[model samples]
Target: MAGTGICCASLEEPIALMKMGLSMVLIGHVNFLLGALVHGVVLRHINLHKQARAMEYAISNVVALTSGLVGIVVGILAIVLSKNKKSKGLTWSLFTVSLTAALMAAASAIGLSVITNECPFDPTRIYSTTLILWVPLIVTCVIQMVFSARCFAVCISFLGLPCCPNRKRTRPYGRAINVVRPLKGSRPISQY
Candidate 1:
Protein backbone atom coordinates (compact mmCIF):
# COMPACT_ATOMS: atom_id res chain seq x y z
CA MET A 1 0.00 0.00 0.00
CA ALA A 2 2.82 2.39 0.80
CA GLY A 3 4.36 2.04 -2.63
CA THR A 4 0.97 2.00 -4.37
CA GLY A 5 1.00 5.75 -4.51
CA ILE A 6 4.25 6.13 -6.46
CA CYS A 7 2.68 6.22 -9.88
CA CYS A 8 -0.25 8.47 -9.06
CA ALA A 9 1.87 10.84 -7.00
CA SER A 10 4.41 11.32 -9.74
CA LEU A 11 1.71 12.15 -12.26
CA GLU A 12 -0.54 14.40 -10.17
CA GLU A 13 2.14 16.84 -9.03
CA PRO A 14 3.77 17.45 -12.39
CA ILE A 15 0.35 18.00 -13.96
CA ALA A 16 -0.53 20.61 -11.37
CA LEU A 17 2.82 22.33 -11.75
CA MET A 18 2.42 22.41 -15.50
CA LYS A 19 -1.10 23.83 -15.28
CA MET A 20 -0.11 26.65 -12.91
CA GLY A 21 3.06 27.57 -14.76
CA LEU A 22 1.31 27.65 -18.12
CA SER A 23 -1.67 29.69 -16.90
CA MET A 24 0.59 32.26 -15.24
CA VAL A 25 2.71 32.56 -18.35
CA LEU A 26 -0.37 33.04 -20.51
CA ILE A 27 -1.83 35.81 -18.38
CA GLY A 28 1.49 37.58 -17.97
CA HIS A 29 2.26 37.44 -21.67
CA VAL A 30 -1.09 38.94 -22.63
CA ASN A 31 -0.80 41.83 -20.25
CA PHE A 32 2.83 42.50 -21.04
CA LEU A 33 2.24 42.49 -24.78
CA LEU A 34 -0.76 44.77 -24.48
CA GLY A 35 1.18 47.29 -22.43
CA ALA A 36 4.14 47.10 -24.77
CA LEU A 37 1.89 47.67 -27.77
CA VAL A 38 0.29 50.67 -26.15
CA HIS A 39 3.70 52.15 -25.50
CA GLY A 40 4.68 51.67 -29.14
CA VAL A 41 1.40 53.16 -30.38
CA VAL A 42 1.73 56.21 -28.17
CA LEU A 43 5.27 56.80 -29.33
CA ARG A 44 4.38 56.25 -32.98
CA HIS A 45 1.43 58.65 -32.86
CA ILE A 46 3.63 61.41 -31.52
CA ASN A 47 6.24 61.08 -34.30
CA LEU A 48 6.96 57.88 -36.21
CA HIS A 49 9.66 58.91 -38.68
CA LYS A 50 11.75 60.48 -35.94
CA GLN A 51 11.38 57.41 -33.77
CA ALA A 52 12.49 54.46 -35.88
CA ARG A 53 13.21 52.44 -32.76
CA ALA A 54 9.61 52.83 -31.63
CA MET A 55 8.45 51.61 -35.03
CA GLU A 56 10.67 48.61 -34.66
CA TYR A 57 9.06 47.96 -31.31
CA ALA A 58 5.60 48.24 -32.86
CA ILE A 59 6.30 45.87 -35.77
CA SER A 60 8.07 43.24 -33.71
CA ASN A 61 5.32 43.37 -31.13
CA VAL A 62 2.59 42.96 -33.74
CA VAL A 63 4.28 39.91 -35.15
CA ALA A 64 4.93 38.45 -31.70
CA LEU A 65 1.42 39.25 -30.51
CA THR A 66 -0.31 36.93 -32.95
CA SER A 67 1.96 33.99 -32.28
CA GLY A 68 2.02 34.67 -28.54
CA LEU A 69 -1.77 34.49 -28.44
CA VAL A 70 -1.78 31.16 -30.21
CA GLY A 71 0.80 29.77 -27.82
CA ILE A 72 -1.10 30.94 -24.73
CA VAL A 73 -4.36 29.45 -25.96
CA VAL A 74 -2.76 26.12 -26.69
CA GLY A 75 -1.09 26.27 -23.28
CA ILE A 76 -4.42 26.87 -21.54
CA LEU A 77 -6.01 23.99 -23.41
CA ALA A 78 -3.16 21.76 -22.38
CA ILE A 79 -3.85 22.71 -18.76
CA VAL A 80 -7.49 21.73 -19.25
CA LEU A 81 -6.44 18.33 -20.45
CA SER A 82 -4.62 17.70 -17.18
CA LYS A 83 -7.90 17.62 -15.29
CA ASN A 84 -9.60 15.09 -17.48
CA LYS A 85 -10.66 11.85 -15.84
CA LYS A 86 -9.78 9.94 -18.92
CA SER A 87 -6.10 10.38 -19.54
CA LYS A 88 -6.09 8.10 -22.56
CA GLY A 89 -6.39 11.00 -24.99
CA LEU A 90 -4.16 13.32 -23.03
CA THR A 91 -0.74 12.34 -24.35
CA TRP A 92 -1.37 13.23 -27.97
CA SER A 93 -3.23 16.44 -27.22
CA LEU A 94 -0.54 17.69 -24.85
CA PHE A 95 2.17 16.68 -27.27
CA THR A 96 0.64 18.65 -30.11
CA VAL A 97 -0.07 21.68 -27.94
CA SER A 98 3.43 21.79 -26.53
CA LEU A 99 4.95 21.41 -29.98
CA THR A 100 2.91 24.35 -31.23
CA ALA A 101 4.01 26.55 -28.33
CA ALA A 102 7.67 25.79 -28.98
CA LEU A 103 7.39 26.64 -32.66
CA MET A 104 5.42 29.82 -32.07
CA ALA A 105 7.83 31.00 -29.40
CA ALA A 106 10.76 30.37 -31.67
CA ALA A 107 9.12 32.41 -34.39
CA SER A 108 8.51 35.30 -32.02
CA ALA A 109 12.10 35.22 -30.83
CA ILE A 110 13.43 35.22 -34.37
CA GLY A 111 11.23 38.12 -35.38
CA LEU A 112 12.46 40.20 -32.45
CA SER A 113 16.08 39.41 -33.29
CA VAL A 114 15.64 40.44 -36.91
CA ILE A 115 14.06 43.76 -35.95
CA THR A 116 16.77 44.58 -33.42
CA ASN A 117 19.52 43.78 -35.89
CA GLU A 118 17.91 45.85 -38.62
CA CYS A 119 17.46 48.83 -36.30
CA PRO A 120 20.81 49.28 -34.59
CA PHE A 121 21.55 52.43 -32.58
CA ASP A 122 22.90 55.29 -34.68
CA PRO A 123 24.81 58.49 -33.80
CA THR A 124 22.51 60.53 -36.06
CA ARG A 125 19.51 59.68 -33.90
CA ILE A 126 18.45 62.61 -31.72
CA TYR A 127 15.47 61.60 -29.64
CA SER A 128 16.34 58.78 -27.28
CA THR A 129 13.82 56.20 -26.10
CA THR A 130 14.44 53.52 -23.52
CA LEU A 131 14.09 50.10 -25.16
CA ILE A 132 13.85 47.79 -22.17
CA LEU A 133 10.67 46.08 -23.33
CA TRP A 134 12.23 43.99 -26.10
CA VAL A 135 14.37 41.83 -23.86
CA PRO A 136 11.46 40.97 -21.58
CA LEU A 137 9.26 40.11 -24.55
CA ILE A 138 11.77 37.59 -25.80
CA VAL A 139 12.28 36.26 -22.31
CA THR A 140 8.54 35.75 -21.87
CA CYS A 141 8.34 33.84 -25.12
CA VAL A 142 11.21 31.63 -24.02
CA ILE A 143 9.50 31.06 -20.68
CA GLN A 144 6.33 29.98 -22.45
CA MET A 145 8.37 27.55 -24.50
CA VAL A 146 9.93 26.15 -21.34
CA PHE A 147 6.56 25.62 -19.70
CA SER A 148 5.29 23.91 -22.83
CA ALA A 149 8.21 21.53 -22.65
CA ARG A 150 7.36 20.77 -19.03
CA CYS A 151 3.77 20.02 -19.99
CA PHE A 152 4.98 17.67 -22.69
CA ALA A 153 7.16 15.87 -20.17
CA VAL A 154 4.16 15.48 -17.89
CA CYS A 155 2.35 13.91 -20.85
CA ILE A 156 5.19 11.50 -21.49
CA SER A 157 5.24 10.45 -17.85
CA PHE A 158 1.61 9.45 -18.18
CA LEU A 159 2.57 7.00 -20.89
CA GLY A 160 4.68 5.03 -18.43
CA LEU A 161 2.08 4.95 -15.66
CA PRO A 162 0.52 1.65 -14.70
CA CYS A 163 -1.88 0.66 -17.50
CA CYS A 164 -5.05 0.36 -15.41
CA PRO A 165 -5.01 4.05 -14.55
CA ASN A 166 -7.01 5.46 -11.61
CA ARG A 167 -9.28 2.49 -11.23
CA LYS A 168 -8.49 0.07 -8.40
CA ARG A 169 -7.98 -3.52 -9.48
CA THR A 170 -8.95 -5.22 -6.23
CA ARG A 171 -11.18 -8.27 -6.13
CA PRO A 172 -14.84 -7.61 -7.05
CA TYR A 173 -16.82 -6.01 -4.20
CA GLY A 174 -18.48 -9.12 -2.78
CA ARG A 175 -15.33 -11.10 -2.28
CA ALA A 176 -14.22 -10.95 1.33
CA ILE A 177 -11.09 -12.31 2.92
CA ASN A 178 -11.77 -15.87 4.05
CA VAL A 179 -10.23 -16.19 7.54
CA VAL A 180 -12.03 -19.48 8.31
CA ARG A 181 -9.25 -21.79 7.15
CA PRO A 182 -5.90 -22.56 8.75
CA LEU A 183 -3.13 -20.14 7.69
CA LYS A 184 -0.89 -23.11 6.95
CA GLY A 185 -1.04 -24.53 3.44
CA SER A 186 -0.99 -21.45 1.30
CA ARG A 187 -0.07 -19.55 -1.73
CA PRO A 188 2.08 -17.06 0.20
CA ILE A 189 -0.13 -14.72 2.23
CA SER A 190 2.04 -11.77 1.28
CA GLN A 191 0.22 -11.07 -2.01
CA TYR A 192 -3.17 -10.82 -0.29
Candidate 2:
Protein backbone atom coordinates (compact mmCIF):
# COMPACT_ATOMS: atom_id res chain seq x y z
CA MET A 1 0.00 0.00 0.00
CA ALA A 2 2.83 2.38 0.86
CA GLY A 3 4.52 1.57 -2.47
CA THR A 4 1.30 2.22 -4.36
CA GLY A 5 0.86 5.55 -2.59
CA ILE A 6 4.40 6.54 -3.45
CA CYS A 7 3.89 5.65 -7.11
CA CYS A 8 0.67 7.63 -7.30
CA ALA A 9 2.28 10.66 -5.71
CA SER A 10 5.16 10.46 -8.15
CA LEU A 11 2.74 10.28 -11.05
CA GLU A 12 0.92 13.50 -10.13
CA GLU A 13 3.48 15.96 -11.46
CA PRO A 14 3.83 14.22 -14.79
CA ILE A 15 0.07 14.12 -15.13
CA ALA A 16 -0.14 17.83 -14.43
CA LEU A 17 2.58 18.59 -16.95
CA MET A 18 0.86 16.51 -19.60
CA LYS A 19 -2.40 18.33 -18.90
CA MET A 20 -0.73 21.68 -19.26
CA GLY A 21 0.92 20.78 -22.55
CA LEU A 22 -2.33 19.43 -23.87
CA SER A 23 -4.11 22.59 -22.79
CA MET A 24 -1.73 24.72 -24.80
CA VAL A 25 -2.05 22.52 -27.84
CA LEU A 26 -5.82 22.47 -27.57
CA ILE A 27 -6.02 26.24 -27.31
CA GLY A 28 -3.89 26.71 -30.42
CA HIS A 29 -5.89 24.21 -32.43
CA VAL A 30 -9.21 25.63 -31.31
CA ASN A 31 -8.14 29.13 -32.26
CA PHE A 32 -7.03 27.99 -35.69
CA LEU A 33 -10.27 26.13 -36.30
CA LEU A 34 -12.26 29.14 -35.18
CA GLY A 35 -10.33 31.34 -37.59
CA ALA A 36 -11.08 29.00 -40.46
CA LEU A 37 -14.74 28.87 -39.56
CA VAL A 38 -14.88 32.64 -39.39
CA HIS A 39 -13.23 32.96 -42.77
CA GLY A 40 -15.67 30.53 -44.36
CA VAL A 41 -18.64 32.31 -42.82
CA VAL A 42 -17.43 35.67 -44.02
CA LEU A 43 -16.75 34.45 -47.51
CA ARG A 44 -20.20 32.95 -47.71
CA HIS A 45 -22.18 35.83 -46.23
CA ILE A 46 -20.19 39.00 -46.72
CA ASN A 47 -19.85 40.64 -50.08
CA LEU A 48 -16.45 41.94 -51.11
CA HIS A 49 -16.59 45.30 -52.79
CA LYS A 50 -14.17 46.99 -55.13
CA GLN A 51 -15.16 50.05 -53.12
CA ALA A 52 -17.05 49.55 -49.87
CA ARG A 53 -19.05 52.40 -48.32
CA ALA A 54 -18.79 53.44 -44.68
CA MET A 55 -21.93 51.49 -43.69
CA GLU A 56 -20.82 48.37 -45.53
CA TYR A 57 -17.40 48.58 -43.91
CA ALA A 58 -19.00 49.02 -40.53
CA ILE A 59 -21.12 45.92 -41.13
CA SER A 60 -18.03 43.92 -41.90
CA ASN A 61 -16.37 45.14 -38.73
CA VAL A 62 -19.42 44.12 -36.73
CA VAL A 63 -19.28 40.63 -38.21
CA ALA A 64 -15.61 40.30 -37.34
CA LEU A 65 -16.08 41.63 -33.84
CA THR A 66 -18.92 39.24 -33.15
CA SER A 67 -17.05 36.27 -34.49
CA GLY A 68 -13.97 37.07 -32.40
CA LEU A 69 -15.92 37.52 -29.19
CA VAL A 70 -17.70 34.22 -29.78
CA GLY A 71 -14.44 32.41 -30.33
CA ILE A 72 -12.86 33.84 -27.20
CA VAL A 73 -15.81 32.82 -25.10
CA VAL A 74 -15.69 29.32 -26.49
CA GLY A 75 -11.96 29.06 -25.83
CA ILE A 76 -12.33 30.32 -22.29
CA LEU A 77 -15.06 27.81 -21.58
CA ALA A 78 -13.00 24.98 -23.00
CA ILE A 79 -10.00 25.89 -20.89
CA VAL A 80 -11.99 26.34 -17.74
CA LEU A 81 -13.60 22.94 -18.10
CA SER A 82 -10.57 20.89 -19.08
CA LYS A 83 -7.44 22.56 -17.69
CA ASN A 84 -5.86 22.85 -14.27
CA LYS A 85 -6.23 26.09 -12.34
CA LYS A 86 -2.94 27.58 -13.42
CA SER A 87 -3.48 26.61 -17.05
CA LYS A 88 -7.03 27.90 -16.90
CA GLY A 89 -5.81 31.25 -15.60
CA LEU A 90 -3.22 31.47 -18.37
CA THR A 91 -5.77 30.63 -21.04
CA TRP A 92 -8.24 33.16 -19.67
CA SER A 93 -5.56 35.85 -19.58
CA LEU A 94 -4.54 35.11 -23.17
CA PHE A 95 -8.15 35.16 -24.35
CA THR A 96 -8.88 38.46 -22.59
CA VAL A 97 -5.74 40.10 -23.91
CA SER A 98 -6.45 38.86 -27.44
CA LEU A 99 -10.03 40.11 -27.29
CA THR A 100 -8.86 43.55 -26.15
CA ALA A 101 -6.31 43.68 -28.93
CA ALA A 102 -8.91 42.57 -31.48
CA LEU A 103 -11.27 45.32 -30.36
CA MET A 104 -8.54 47.89 -30.82
CA ALA A 105 -7.75 46.51 -34.26
CA ALA A 106 -11.40 46.50 -35.28
CA ALA A 107 -11.91 50.08 -34.14
CA SER A 108 -8.78 51.26 -35.88
CA ALA A 109 -9.71 49.43 -39.05
CA ILE A 110 -13.19 50.92 -39.06
CA GLY A 111 -11.95 54.44 -38.36
CA LEU A 112 -9.35 54.22 -41.07
CA SER A 113 -11.81 52.84 -43.56
CA VAL A 114 -14.18 55.71 -42.79
CA ILE A 115 -11.52 58.39 -43.01
CA THR A 116 -9.81 57.16 -46.16
CA ASN A 117 -13.06 56.21 -47.97
CA GLU A 118 -11.33 52.95 -48.79
CA CYS A 119 -12.56 49.40 -48.55
CA PRO A 120 -11.52 47.73 -45.34
CA PHE A 121 -9.88 45.03 -47.42
CA ASP A 122 -7.90 47.53 -49.47
CA PRO A 123 -4.19 47.36 -48.79
CA THR A 124 -3.20 50.70 -50.28
CA ARG A 125 -5.33 53.20 -48.35
CA ILE A 126 -5.49 51.44 -44.99
CA TYR A 127 -2.34 53.05 -43.68
CA SER A 128 -3.08 56.60 -44.84
CA THR A 129 -3.65 57.50 -41.18
CA THR A 130 -0.68 56.44 -39.09
CA LEU A 131 -2.47 56.61 -35.74
CA ILE A 132 -5.39 54.55 -36.95
CA LEU A 133 -3.21 51.90 -38.51
CA TRP A 134 -0.18 51.58 -36.22
CA VAL A 135 -1.68 51.90 -32.76
CA PRO A 136 -3.68 48.70 -32.91
CA LEU A 137 -0.83 46.85 -34.61
CA ILE A 138 1.55 47.89 -31.85
CA VAL A 139 -0.97 46.93 -29.19
CA THR A 140 -1.46 43.49 -30.74
CA CYS A 141 2.27 42.95 -31.16
CA VAL A 142 2.86 43.76 -27.52
CA ILE A 143 0.05 41.45 -26.49
CA GLN A 144 1.53 38.66 -28.61
CA MET A 145 5.00 39.15 -27.12
CA VAL A 146 3.71 39.18 -23.58
CA PHE A 147 1.58 36.11 -24.17
CA SER A 148 4.56 34.28 -25.66
CA ALA A 149 6.78 35.18 -22.72
CA ARG A 150 4.16 34.00 -20.27
CA CYS A 151 3.70 30.71 -22.12
CA PHE A 152 7.45 30.13 -22.20
CA ALA A 153 7.77 30.86 -18.51
CA VAL A 154 4.89 28.54 -17.69
CA CYS A 155 6.26 25.73 -19.83
CA ILE A 156 9.70 26.13 -18.29
CA SER A 157 8.21 25.95 -14.82
CA PHE A 158 5.90 23.03 -15.50
CA LEU A 159 7.74 20.97 -18.09
CA GLY A 160 11.32 22.29 -17.95
CA LEU A 161 11.33 23.07 -21.67
CA PRO A 162 11.14 26.55 -23.09
CA CYS A 163 8.19 27.18 -25.37
CA CYS A 164 9.21 28.19 -28.86
CA PRO A 165 7.93 31.47 -30.23
CA ASN A 166 5.68 30.99 -33.25
CA ARG A 167 7.63 33.31 -35.49
CA LYS A 168 10.69 31.82 -37.16
CA ARG A 169 13.39 33.53 -39.18
CA THR A 170 14.68 31.53 -42.09
CA ARG A 171 18.43 31.81 -42.69
CA PRO A 172 20.15 30.84 -45.92
CA TYR A 173 23.89 30.45 -45.42
CA GLY A 174 24.73 33.59 -43.41
CA ARG A 175 21.91 35.71 -44.77
CA ALA A 176 18.59 36.17 -43.00
CA ILE A 177 15.45 35.72 -45.11
CA ASN A 178 11.85 36.54 -44.32
CA VAL A 179 9.65 33.85 -45.81
CA VAL A 180 6.43 35.63 -44.87
CA ARG A 181 7.34 38.99 -46.38
CA PRO A 182 4.38 41.15 -47.25
CA LEU A 183 3.79 41.65 -50.96
CA LYS A 184 2.48 45.15 -50.23
CA GLY A 185 4.35 47.29 -47.72
CA SER A 186 1.21 48.83 -46.29
CA ARG A 187 1.09 47.04 -42.95
CA PRO A 188 2.90 48.53 -39.99
CA ILE A 189 6.06 46.78 -38.86
CA SER A 190 6.61 46.06 -35.19
CA GLN A 191 10.21 46.06 -34.02
CA TYR A 192 11.14 43.43 -31.47
lDDT of each structure? Answer: 0.57, 0.40
List, residue by residue over 20-119, the lDDT tens digit for candidate 2.
3344344334433433443443323434553345345445444434433433443343334335635645545544544553454345344423445443
- State every prediction's TM-score relative to the real structure: 0.53, 0.27
Model 2: worst 10 consecutive residues (lDDT sum): 5-14
RMSD in order of candidates: 9.3, 22.3
Give the Cα error of residue 15 in candidate 1, in Å.
5.9
Tell me, by TM-score, which candidate is best: 1
Model 2, position 176, has a per-residue lDDT of 65
Clashes of each: 0, 0
Q: Tell me, by lDDT, which candidate is best.
A: 1
Model 1: residues >4 Å from true position, as ranges? Answer: 1-15, 18-28, 31-60, 114-130, 159-192
